[model samples]
Target: MNFKKCLRCGCFFASEDSVCPSCQTKDEIDKNSIRNYLANNDTPQNAESLAFQSGVSIKNINRFMETKEFSPLKNSFK
Candidate 1:
């Protein structure tokens, strides 16, 4: 079995996921907030701006971007 530490919780888990299940739930919530913010607003935002506006962390946003989960908003960067 492969064991890896979760980036968010720093707990070791046996999986290929970057974050553990608990942190994944929280990340989902954050993602929803970011999506809602993007849907409701037209202002261009970069990782830092999005983090500030959505109350999410820059690390999480960058991770999402890196995984291409937030590719639609990638072009919104200013």
Candidate 2:
């Protein structure tokens, strides 16, 4: 089956569902929210370095990356 991730909680589930189990209790944003989140975040490497230096958890950073909500680094893989 094809898979589409939940924009609210970043959980991959049955796309037919109206909401993700994790974010079902809270308000869920539409496609616009996801685009905005991606644009607002995902800064440059300098910011990522600063966040890391300031003690942001690797897990959280990675989680954000997977969400497609965070665009912290443009050329992160490079």
Candidate 3:
């Protein structure tokens, strides 16, 4: 795997790790948040619009929806 420098701390490491160990902030999208956005509404819809409505980032929504790795937690939104 290729290495990348952390945006927050300037630590160099493998790109496979989502965030730098030095920085708690995530470089990759959060799937749980994305799933919460997608597995909503009575009607099927676009991910971007869903993200807007759900107040999650569009990039995160797109990543989860496209990857199809969204695991919804039941009754979480309620």
Candidates in order, TM-scores: namely 0.86, 0.30, 0.44
The lDDT for every candidate, in the order shown, is 0.85, 0.49, 0.51
Tens-digit lDDT track of model 2 for 1-43: 6576875567788766544676554423333443454467654
In Å, residue 8's CA in model 3 sits off its true spot by: 12
TM-score of 3: 0.44
Better of 1 and 2 by TM-score: 1
Note the residue pairs that clash in candidate 2: 42-71, 42-72, 43-72
TM-score of 2: 0.30
The top-ranked prediction according to TM-score is 1
Best by lDDT: 1
Please say which candidate is ahead in TM-score: 2 or 3: 3
How do these models rank on TM-score, best leading? 1, 3, 2
Q: How many clashes show up in model 2?
A: 3
lDDT of 3 by residue, 1-78 (tens): 789876445788887654476553442435444445456754235555556776666655444443434424222222
Candidate 3 C-alpha error for residue 65, in Å: 2.9
